[model samples]
Target: MGPSSQSATVTASLDQLETVAAQLFPAWLPGAEGIATTAGGGLAAVRSLAIAHAAGTAQYSPFLVDLAVGALAGAGPNTRRHPPEMRAAGLARVIAAALGRPGCALLLRPPDDLDENEALALVRAAQWLVDHGRLAVWISSGSPAPGDLLPEAGIARPAGTTAAGRPGPKVHSTVRGTVRCGRTTDDHYPGERQPGKSRRAGRHGKPHPASRTETLLEAALATRPWAVGRAWNHTLSPGPLVNPVRVDLLWKRERCVVELDGDDHRSAGKYADDRQRDVLLQLDGYAVLRFTNAQVHDDIENVLALLQQFLATRRRTRKGH
Candidate 1:
């Protein structure tokens, strides 16, 4: 994709490639941007990296592949909102190899009925970068979710906190790929849309363990319009509740909670406890939507649309009240 870190003396070699492509590669390299430079800076940068990477002169790392493919992700007539399609695209072998497993996938994914193929892939890939270490993702046309198939293979996200006291953005750096938090995170940077922007459900923490279903419902309330498109990754709590609810997707602005009801919620013993919890949530004025693993895969759009209509009706009723 962009730069080859796998080559010997990656930094030094990249430096030489940069010199050759001075007018090309350096322009967008932060300091290079806005500053004056020689002609063909961008082209030269791409050319140098491409040539070196193409030849054995540079060690071809996934980093380079990701850089190249990502450039297409943003620009090019072929650039896309959903990356998996672009990834599955039968283009350069480097793109295929760059779009490798684990790196370009998410441990958790959004609903199955995703709209834009490339964007979905990008979201999945970005989430992977956050959960695991950032790796290179090559551009294929539409292939998505290698991570789901290879959860054991991802690079574990480096251990540290951001300046904000949470896992900071830029968990890893890339030569070409532009990385940021997924559309699903609670805290979006400037200009990024925050759907649950109004509701003050104390968004600082993740879902509570015993109360995961409760907190996730609150979070889903914020992402109502695109609930089905939302997700959760970072761990907010770790408790006795095995396989706790990790994310809550909003179908509409309705206060509905769609949890990945596993054995914990289905088993006969835990059924009573789950019902009691649901009763309490209703007392708090939440609808508390529930879905099984089968529901998510078999009838996603139907369930999501139904939930949206349900929420819409509920909102109307609340206002009327």
Candidate 2:
């Protein structure tokens, strides 16, 4: 296929993925709290977790945690000395940091070589999280199967269909980015690119792969003279006391911020957080224009036109003042 055709195919696949995610996530997560088990294994399990983590709903904030790396993986012989309760506590802290809100749900992927004792420990840890932390946990279907270890009551076998066939390269690549094993002391998850790093730079300073939405928007903006001086992923602090906010696109001189939100923003907690951030930006005399990732994927021309109009108006308004 030609380059344009390949791009179009990827965009269509992403749209379909988003639609499937919207339908399946609500049934899998149900509400803001409790533990459960989802049906499916292998790529299906990965797809479900990836979509849930990437596109959350109004009721729950979902995160994908792999038990193969970081502290959680210490359940092996090396860390067998630590009690399961202590291990559970460590897991809980990681979850709390990743979700950082009520109605948090974890889609856990157990290691493939999980033994009976390790399975039991995870089951106990999951129960502890649900009881003490009020977290909703879903152990995705894997090698050992979470159902065999978990209590019947904790098993939530929701019936839903996921997107068939393999996802495009772009969607497949997001799996690693969406899953979290642990967090650093700075509150950023391991492997997350820190702010102030050039957008073009990936780990080891390699050229970063831009998302389809980002690439399209950047191309559109490049042709427009007025779009110059804008920044991508710029950090702004409204005040010293308040924490700094990183914006997707910023025109500092015009005081205009454009945010491209993913499906996760539709979740109740995320929606509230976005509103709060917008308020802080507004208070600091900046206009915030928000767009969904899907919107940018579907209609780049419309997005660019709206952005042009907004920037022009902002320029005139600032000049008048």
Candidate 3:
């Protein structure tokens, strides 16, 4: 048996935390590949686990801290396969936990009555969590949230921190080197072009404009300045389709198009739709290219290079046009 000393205080630093997770993660995550980013994980991960717990998931294994932060940060990895609602719910729970609140069921399904400050506090907290992703905590995978995982007794915010008068029942998220919520500040968050949401799936928080296309475009942006998507335009002679016909990727002036050929694109139903769309757009003189998902993933760099060549050719063509 290990030393059984009731008096021994065991403190966990970020280093200690990473060590524990490194040993535990591999066993828990079977067939885990590549380098583990756990050493860099921090508060965002911690906030997420609390969220997973509150979401009534007894098994936190399914919802790691990194996954939660990814969802919050709009950075998806393999975790995207999970339902978006799960991510949303996890984010919600994390915010509630940050405020020293338990039983987040109440926040989502609040009691019949809640005061003005209580309601405002809730909104401010969610905004804070979403905007300022726990950048200080480096681990890109999973880490613990700051403060008590479960707040003990009466809630607390930093002393003399409240700007809008006396503190309410809500616990504020105190980010190091970041402006605290439920207070006044001139601080603007990172991401000059970050999207904001009014509400999430059955959860009270701001969601972003992140969709499947946004994610794909974001991934593409890392390498290439151009990405193709099914976009709509009303400037055509026939005034475009009834809705946006999937154009894959369209380089306007240079006139290029790219397609993501998933199984859906091969199936008769989807293929027919795609062919009709492609035919119409092609008739409009758009230079089209196609690639499979495997091709994109297997060699993104090569694919991006091809696109750069296309863009260059198109630039010349546009000059002629």
Top candidate (TM-score): 2
**Please, what are the lDDT tens digits per residue for candidate 3 over residues 65-154?**
554344334343424454443433443334434344442211011222434443333333332222232211111001111122213213
For all the candidates, what are their Cα RMSDs to the real structure?
A: 19.5, 21.5, 24.4
What ranking of all candidate models by TM-score puts the best one first? 2, 3, 1
lDDT by residue for model 2 (23-45), tens: 23223332312222332343344
Model 1: lDDT equals: 0.32
Q: Tell me each candidate's TM-score.
A: 0.26, 0.37, 0.29
Q: Candidate 1 on 160-225: residue-level lDDT in tens? A: 232356321112112212111112232223332233232223232344333333343445445665
Query: Model 1 off-target regions past 4 Å?
Result: 1-253
Error in Å for residue 240 of model 2? 1.4
- Clashes within 3 Å, all models in order: 41, 1, 11
- TM-score comparison, 1 vs 2, better candidate: 2
| lDDT leader | 2
Find the number of clashing residue pairs for candidate 2.
1
Lowest lDDT sum, 10 consecutive residues, model 2, at 171-180
